[model samples]
Structure formats: structure tokens, C-alpha cells
Target chain A: MNEKLDITLTVNGRSHALGVEPRRNLADALRDDLGLTGTHVGCEHGVCGACTVLMDGRPVRSCLTFACQAEGAAIETVEGLADGDRLHPLQQKFWELHGLQCGFCTPGMLMLAAGALRENPDMDDEEIREVMSSNLCRCTGYQNILRAVRAAADVMRAEGAQG
Target chain B: MKPASFSYHKPGSVSAALALLAQFGEEGKIIAGGQSLVPSMNFRLARPETLIDINHIAEIQGVSDQGDHLEIGAVTRHATFHHPVSPCPLGRMLTKVVANIAHYPIRQRGTFGGSLSHADPASEWCLVAVTMGAEMEIHGPAGARRVPAAQFFRGTFTTAVGRDELLARIRLPKLPEGWGTGFYEFSRRKGDFALAMALAALKVEGGTIRAARLGLGAVGAHPQRLEALEAELTGQPATPQTFAAIGARAQTMVTPSGDIHGSAEYRRELAATVIARALTRAAEDAA
Candidate 1:
């Protein structure tokens, strides 16, 4: 039997030590070993952002990143977006705007959008399109997705102002 | 599709990485970010027996500004160059282009050295690296060597890199005070590979052109530096007429090949237009 390599990773503020092959992708490792399937796999070629996850606060395609490459790295999958049962603002906007149809691309889109919003909370429509262009959703024509991002931005801003 | 089985080694130091390269030779491949290599491996386009992962090598990551030149580690992420606070406008522009490359997720995992080593003629980073006259520092079993941008790239998907060598850092000389730069590319979509691209850098003195450097990509086997056009611009007055003449000279400098997105003649014409536009913008910036 091929010896499994030891890997230590921090996911969603929790640390885990696992044994796996060096060739295992972060997306596969998250879904199969850790049982966090929120990070979807689409196009596998980095063209599609279905497997997007936050690595040290930056969104990266988990499908293209080797698990060995992510050793000792801090990762946040879609499962970490919400605080317990309380939904993230982006998730609320996604739900309110019907930003998804099949929901396969939702988790990735939500993560990317959340990252973008955190970086630029006041992002306008064109800016949202420019940033969201990376993620592809064949089910949605991208109009509602754009609306969801804008709606979420507004919610984030309103919450900030209220506080 | 899963990547073919391969042994992986994580070297902690640059010297250790080079030693691994020497031990494995052509049977090994270096993985940084793994944006391009992983996909290629899964497709069976390239399958090596050993994979030397260099992400943990501390000496081969980050950016260093040494007064006269900027030393960029090979493993520096593309996002580092794109940050808004970048000292060099050229560096900032590269970051913006890289941000739009594929998508944010890909850029997060892609390294500047990986992109340059990939040497895709259509890649914007390769064209910019050539235009800026960047020098690549390489370490191998034979010791360390530096190759100037002009000689670094050999051909499409090829460079001066050897099997037992790893690119360690990229050295870019600080631009002269009057130097102005511009980069432009036309793609099918926002994040698609460039159909045609142009980059121009020029130094102007009192309305006269002191020096000029121009480069074009995706139109040839390798990115071409417009020496002929640059020669015509030197010592001439920096004006619309001078730019027009340089554009005319650029038309004959490259013979773009036809591709799925555009025809040969169309790319040639687009090259001329982009060159003119880039030169004009760069000249304005210098002024």
C-alpha cells in the first residue's frame, strides 16, 4: 500500500491532521475526508469557480490547489460563511433575490461575493459584474446574481450605518 | 479526472529545492501554486515521476525592493503585484490584468514565476516581463545564473530554464524618472486569453523621445520587442505624427498568425491599432 502523507490544515477555525496522498485536491479532501461538501467542483480547470474557498481570506479554486500545497494553511469553505443558524448577509440576499436555480454554483458564488463585499462594501453594479464574472452559473443568466450582490452590499452598508 | 500518481517532496530552502531538482532531473517537475501544472497533469499532457513542491521554501517567496531594482521571489502570488499600493504603475497594471485572468480564484493560486515559466505567448505577464527587461535568477546543480528578459524566453511554452534548475527570483530595474508605460490587450471576453496584446514604455525629454520600448504578444511564437519601431521613435519629437509613423513601422514588424478568435490580417491591424494607442497613452503618462 502507498504510504499516506501527513497533512495538517486549519479549516473554519478548527485544526485537523489527516493522512492522504499528495495528489489529493483541497476540494476533494474537503468533500470526501472532512465531509464538507459545500465547496462544489465544476469545470475543475480553474475556469469555473464552483470550488472557490477562502484561503487566508483570499478566494482560491480548491479544485486546482493540491492538498499538500495547502498544508498548514487556513481555509474557509462555504460551510463557515454563516454563524451557526444565523445566515450571512450574502446568503440572505441570495435567498431573497433567488440568485440560484440548481444551487450547485451557489456556495462558490456566495463565498466569492462575500469576499468581494468584505473587500469593497460599496461596490456598484459594474464593479460587481466585473468581480462576479469569474464564477459561471449556467442556470442563472447572471442578472439576478448581480442583483443579489448589489442587494447584499446594501444590506452590509445599512448594518454598518446602524451600528 | 485525477492526476497521475507521483512522488512529492517539500523542500524548505532554495538550496534544498535545487538539490531535489538535481536528484530527479527531467523526471521531476516543480509545483508552485499548481494552477497550470495540475490541469496539464490531469489531462496527461505532462506526467512526471516526481513533483518537487516549492511552496514552503521561504527564500523563494515575497517581494523585495532594493533601491535600484525590485527583486520578486519566484513564488510571489500574482495578487501581490496587483495590490493598489504597488510602487510601480507597471506592477499595478500587471496586477489588474492578472486579477482579470481566468478569475480571482485562479489568481490566488497562480504565481508570477509559474506564469512566466509557462511562457504562453498569449499570456500578458510574459509580454510585460519582456517589455520591462526583467531578469530571471535561476538556481540549479550548476549554481546560480541570471538571464535577461530578451534571452530568457526561447519559444512558446519554453524558456532558458533547464531540467535541474529552478527559477528563484525576477529582477526588474527601477524605471527612469521620465519613463512612461502602457499595456493593452483585446480578448473575446473579460477574462479570456488575449487575442492580441501590446505594451509600450518610453522616456520623453522636453517633447522629444529619448528612448522607446514596445512589445507585442499572441502574434508570434514568442512575444516580440518592437526594435524597428523603437529605433524610429528615438530622437524624434514625441507627437501624434511620431506615434502614427511608429504605428506604421509596427505593422511590418509582426506577422500574426490566424487563430479561432481572429484572422491573421485582423490581428495585424489590431496590433497596429493597439501599438498606436499604447504609445499615445504612455507618452501622455510620461508628460
Candidate 2:
């Protein structure tokens, strides 16, 4: 409730103008101000990647980014992944492969994977596990998560080659 | 937890940012990527009255190859070193060290100048800077000055960058031809802070070590160059015996304090092992 700074950010292809405190982080602004809520904050520090989001096509820790710093940048959250009724291929693979049990880390994991796949769709199992290890998960033991990302990568690569 | 209230200033130019730094002095902190500073602020560890965001300063934001050296802008992201958008001769060594720095998301936002200014003892960039003899270009009200990496880091979490100055660029010298480098790290986790690490770059000619540069991290208050080891390796055959002896000598060079991560004794032993392994790798690469 101190002095609030005005910022305009493009989130999920939609522009939002809001007044935010300089101290407010990006994860809080997205969840509280915009009501997106998909980006969860577990550690609130850079160690845990639960608040991961794509910033201008690169995955960044939203909890570590101030809302004021995100002005004029394009951000993509987990809510922006699905295409209306149809789930993203990564989301479908996660559901089919049981990638989540508690589902707390699923949103951040999806955002990280989406960004990673977008950059390189031909990631192998080791690369997938190595890249996904940033987002810590206590629930599903990570085997299913690894399998899900692999499956999604295969599908995404085939889809990319097709179109 | 959230950070306390503070004013944010996004300067459009490097001079404007420096002016803000001079105006605020110790009360101001520069934010390049905010990966480390924001987390510390959220934990209530750092509460600067004003945050000078230098991310918008376009002048200090990319890599420039200067023929003999690579000039990396202050705001150059860690991910850029891994998959360099521009030409970089230090690509091999950078790829190995970048992966060992935190994780993918952190690399996406963390910057070279931020890491250098933060000056964590276990930071891979600090070790790399010392091993490569890089220079830090700093700008302030007094104008610009370049400090060699050896004199840049003062102590744990401290550097030569004045409170009213900003790190503008890092100048990393080109490795000489016939040189090979190795970065060996032993962190508890893949992307966690290293418990102990070794950086080695060697030039072997006619099966003899011509020149060697060695650095150790997480075994002391700051990453330090092992000048004695470097001198001892000169003129000797690049062999396992020499590396073993170098490892033993390196164990006596550091003074590490016992902490939650590990004991001083454990770190010394770990440092020796990593040094030996790094030397072997560097020799193989040179061959």
C-alpha cells in the first residue's frame, strides 16, 4: 500500500495495465492482481522454481522478478498453455503419464518444460531430466514427470516437423 | 515473505544509471537480473532504499568480441554464455561452468555483472574470472576504471566495485592457442552451490607444460589463483605424477572455515581431488 508504480505487461498475448507496489514480485502480481493463480510460490526464493514463467520466450523465476521490472515484457504462465478446451500436448502427456500427485509443482514444471521444448524440441531423456530438475517436486517421485516430458517432446517434435 | 517498500528507477542509459548510483550512494543497489538480490530481499536480508534497475540500459547488454578478448556487457545473461548468440572463443569452458551455476531458470535471469558484484566464494564465474585473468570495467562519478579480476574480488561477498560505481563490462582474455581448459566441481546437487571446485587451463608444447593457470573455489573466503601450483607445473611433463603432486601441494594453499555445507578438512581433501582431476582433464584436452 505504499507508492504504487504503473506498469503494462503482455501476459498470455493479452495486455494488462495495473498499479503495483515496487516491492511486489512478478509471481504475486500475476496471481493476486491478475488472478491467474497458476504460478505457485513455494520457496519465494530462486532455489525453488515453483514460480517459473516464460519471460520473452525464456523461462525465469517469477518469484525472483519484481513486477515493476516486467514492464513491456511478454510473459506466459501455465494458464496460457492450454488451447481453450484442448489441453497442451505437455499437459495431456502429464495427465496421461500421471506426472503429478499433489500437483503443487505441476504448473511451474509445465511452464519450464514448455519453454525448454520451444527452444529445443529434440531433448533426450537426460536433457529433459537435467532441465526439469530446477523445479523441485516432492510428490510423484519424478519418474512419471520425466516420462511425461519425454512423451511431450516426441509429440512436439513430430508436430513441428509436420507443420 | 516479500521485500519491503523501495523506489525503483529504470534508467534508459548507462550514464543515467551511474548518476542514480552517485545520487543514492550506499542507499541504492543496482538490479541487473535480480535472481540473487530479489531472493535476498524477499528474505529480509537486503533492504536498499532505492533499486537502480540497469536492465533497460541497452549499452551494457550484449557481448562484443574485441579480437584479442571478449567484452561481455554487464547485463549479459548467464544463458547467453551457454548458448552464445555471438562469437565467443571461451565457449567450451563457459558451457561447463554455466551448467554448474544454480539451474536453468536462474541462468535465464542471472547476469555476469550481478554474479561478479555479488562475489559469492563458490560462484563458478568468480573462479572462471580468476583463471582467465578477466578484467572488470567499472563506471562511477569519477569516470571509468578497469580492475583485473585478481584484484577485483576483495573478500567473501565483497568486491572492488565501489558503492557508487556500477560494473559495466567484463573483459575476458582469449585463451592462447594449444591451450585446453577444465572445470571440475563437486556440489551436493547438480545445480547447487559448489562445496569445492577447481578450474584449470593449460598449454602443453612438445609434451611439456608451457603455462598453467589454476583456480580454486568454495575452499576459502574467495576464489583464489594457485600461483605456486602454476609455477611448479611449468617446464614439467604433463603427467599423472605432476598432477598428483600438484594436488597435494594445493591442499596446503587454502584456509577454509567449517560451515553447514562441509568441514574445513573435508573441503581441503575435496579440493585436492578436484584439482587433480581437473589437471588430468586439462592435459588430455591439450593433447
Fraction of native contacts (fnat) of each candidate: 0.61, 0.85
lDDT of 2 by residue, A65-107 (tens): 9988998889999999999999999999999999999999999
Please list the residue runs of candidate 2 whose C-alpha ends up more than 4 Å from where it truly belongs after superposition. B84-89
Per-residue CA lDDT of candidate 1, range B189-262, in tens?
Answer: 98888877888888999999898888888788788887877888899998888887777777787887887788
* Predicted structure 1: lDDT: 0.83
Ten contiguous residues minimizing lDDT sum, candidate 2 chain A: A118-127
Residue B79 of model 2: what lDDT? 88
- Report lDDT (Cα) of residue A159, candidate 1: 91
Report clashes for each candidate as comma-separated counts: 1, 0
- What digit string (tens of lDDT, one per residue) describes model 1 on residues A125-153? 88799889989999989999999989888
Q: What's the C-alpha lDDT at position B74 in model 2? A: 91
Q: Residue B147: error of model 2 in Å?
A: 0.9
Off by over 4 Å in 1: A160-163, B84-100, B205-208, B235-241
Lowest-sum lDDT 10-residue window in model 2 chain B: B82-91
On lDDT, the leading prediction is 2
Report clash pairs, candidate 2. Answer: none
